[model samples]
Target: MPVEEHDPFEDQFASALRQAGGTFESHRLDLAARGETRGRKIRRRRAAIAGGVTGVALVGLGGALVLPGIQTDGGRRHSVAGSPSAPPTPAASPTRPSAMSADDVVRTLERLLPKGKFSGEEGRGTGEQLPPYARVVYDDGKGKAAVAVMVDRVRPGGSQALETTACPDKVFVPYDACTSGRLADGSTLMILQGYEYPDRRVDTKLWSAELVTPKGQHISVQEWNAPAEKGAPVSRSRPPLSPDQLKMLAGAAAWRSVADAIPADPRVPTAEPSRSQGVPGGSVSATLATLLPKGAEVVKKGVADPGFGYVVIDDGKGASMVQVNVQADMSGLANQLFGSGSRTLPDGTRVATHQGPGDKGGRGVVMWTVDTMRPDGRRVVISAFNSGTQHTPATREAPALTPKQMETIATSERWFSRD
Candidate 1:
């Protein structure tokens, strides 16, 4: 049976959540069920909370994860069982590495953490159905918190590696602070202080550190103010670990050995170049900037991504966020995305408009959208939010651009130009 196509608006909304590290587990299940019907995977790293619908090539602790380009082929590793309190040490020889057991993975995390009482411990070691992870509910005297860590690998200098370290745009992600830099050992590290919910509906704070070594060791550490990532009361004003502590935990050397023991995915060739499979995000943002209505001051812009771009604008009324997605060969989805309300242009183009409440749980937020498709199956979707981000309360009565203005921007010939 063919998988039914999802509503395009929902997909775009979920993409924003994924990039912002917002929780949307149902979306993940939907994407899994849809399977290959979804085209190329756009990977993202979640430093704090995890959710949103995208191809999660790797799993991480506390549901927070790193995104790699290709899916693992479920390769197996030789597991040597050990005690949770005292995991078996790997052999000295890198040539003859010993696999860590699930217990070993958990024990390593426990040992590296500061003095704390640990419970609800769980872990997946190398050769598991999913990637390796270790999570525990830790109480460091002040409060009980959830701390998790995951180790994986990515292609060195690949798009996955770069994305893992890049700071998310505040226009999409409402983080308090974020920093990314290279270490003395050529490792890239990023620490993010953000909320578990993009909307800040709850005050649960989330902080995380991501470290990618020169040899492709991908480590992510996440901690939340509550005992769990979600569905829990905030146990403290902030997460248990400070930014520096999170960084130290992620940079621990023990994880690299665990990464080494994990077997490689047979499907992802090692030499694959780190390039986008869609229209470069820089091109989209540049084009969108050029098409903005006169005198609209650009407050912020999104990171250079492929096929997606966003900008925050304030036309004197208040801050508003405008985002666009440029996709090629989307004709297969036209019938599902467009309906009777859509109209056809004289040049064989299709146009659809929508005005509705924001789907991301922000209070009093509205979304205005213009979706367009050319005869050649190229898709350009433009959406504006009343708030600077979809997850925030409305800052104005409506989006900066009226529906007609959005339509004009969506249909402009400037979008058709080559990057």
Candidate 2:
């Protein structure tokens, strides 16, 4: 299960800001899709964050502040660091400051605001090759707000700089209040006040403040009540700074010389990649309750496998979830993951199927799948959902199983006798 080769946009913002391991082993089928155009795009454009580093290069690396001739609804402008693959100008050695000048980080963030009155500023200065931000729109009289800062880097002593301080992954982000710490010079700060839907459906709060720097920079400072962070509409109920002013604007030491002049992914890997193994969540819910199919009824279950799992059945006509995955050996990954409307079996086994239309938000819901494999690579996938959750909504209207009972439970042999 240490299956390698993956960087779907660094698993889309490392699974939209990861952190969860009180125990539940782990799970990741495209890390439960959070990107590929905002999760569950039904699997095609092959999430690699859409190739060659875009989203203006993860907004220079840690994302969330974003604002530099912004365009994207398919327009394109995003520039903030002289990019042409910016990254070859390093020679200084003294205690920092060879370059990076977003107007001295917008005058040290409008001279460390708090007496507030700031307004409409934009940022990006590290002599351009992009990755350093600072936005403004404060109002202190209480209403108009949105303050930003992004500066990036993180891989020094990696583990993504200790999970960028921690607290995310409430099964895919939905926050309310958070805090984290460490810093006597070792650096690590946190302070979340989440909601941009992890299933609040959308109350749109989004407060943030993450630090991390043991040399792998990653300062972030999100704010949102609406001025941006997705087609604005909330206006203001929270987000004017407080969580100790977002931990003093993410521990600002002037964003450590613009994260020491950002640049550190010269193709990363001084270490940090080897965690991915699955199957233990009660043996993946006892091998998906042995392929149920008689008046169903299972209630809710979860076990995002050593490979993946799920249940949530009901059969009396409402709730339906049914999910599963297995993946062993994988014959050098079947010609780039099954294509040309796959189909092979004559005992060689290959198959593929789909019914589709449930991309994460699950509106009217409906999905039914069956993907098999086995020339000696043993794979088996399955799906079904009229929904009991993929956030919510949709109680029925197809999918309690059937696509030939999900292709006989994805070509079963008891999922190859539980490996």
Candidate 3:
């Protein structure tokens, strides 16, 4: 007889937790001879709570990860590994890379990597001191995506290595990874996820890593991308000194040096929020009739998202975001930037309007930003990019924000005013 198939709910539950950035080892599940179906539903509910589900009223829609718990708009809850409510506002400026030891970093990375059947090679090389850390590179030839680990070199034991895991797999294994599509400029993009063992934190840390092509330049997954859509797009600097240079810089302890020095996530480069203005306890929403020009009507608001809110606003002209993440909803705004609305792509992906067209045939300007503090205080940013262009499905087609623009938006004084 064929082996019995397990309940799909349990499998989906484990998968969601992994995707939501949770680490649930296999041993944690106790389904042995137990009512498997009940266990699966319970598992999903737990994952939803852990990831902070933003009630997505899923109408007949299907896109990757358009599931129950994950944030449909790319942002996720940045909570401590175990807590439910907003992660404690970490003490230091959150959003920097972690510092660790070379040996520990590599060993931790290896443990996190998925096992077997992969066809890539793993080689290690050191790098020159790259500030807060030294560097080690890991590349298993499968496209240009490679891993660049940064460590704190000054500390005798500091050293770190970044590597890639296989993609499109079924179970949650160490080092499993994937990437965003290619940009207009001929570059392949990939995202890496792995367990990090830093000197400061004892528990395994899960972090996102972005690998950019051509010369294999690597930056913290969080730092490589800018925080605002209006800001100048950031370009990767030349590939840092080769692995040889890394070793020379840190000497025998380069890995440790780099690992220990990997800085915490950077501050939201845009106009930073004042300590006086804290994250709000609730969200805001408004009817389309109240805010948009005539013909434009407000569709239902997406479930409240702490980092960003999604509303379906429409006019015969088309619908797009009037404001994003600025409020729980779009109740207060003196000026309506037609450009600032929400739009749904042919593929069914919903994007907040920034500095682009209001919608097909729509017009106006809208601006906003998203800054998330990781459980450990590291930050992730997504800002609006202003420009005139129709929203299209192509990733390369999106207009980019300039550096000066980024600074201006970062410094904007009236982001949270209740007017």
Which candidate should be chosen as best, given TM-score against the real structure?
1
Off by over 4 Å in 3: 1-144, 150-275, 278-281, 284-310, 324-419
lDDT of 2: 0.56
Name the lDDT value of residue 41 in candidate 1.
17
TM-score of every candidate = 0.76, 0.33, 0.26
TM-score of 1: 0.76
lDDT of 1 by residue, 58-106 (tens): 2110122333222222321212233231234445465635777767988
Query: How accurate locally, in lDDT, is each candidate?
Result: 0.65, 0.56, 0.26
lDDT tens per residue, model 3, 178-296: 44444354323334332221111222222343223332222222111111111223222222223233222222233333333333222212222222211244332332113334453
Number of backbone collisions per candidate: 1, 13, 75
Error of 2 at 24 (Å): 20
Weakest 10 consecutive residues of candidate 2 by summed lDDT: 41-50
RMSD of each: 8.9, 17.5, 22.1
The order by descending lDDT is 1, 2, 3
* Model 3 C-alpha lDDT versus the unseen true structure: 0.26
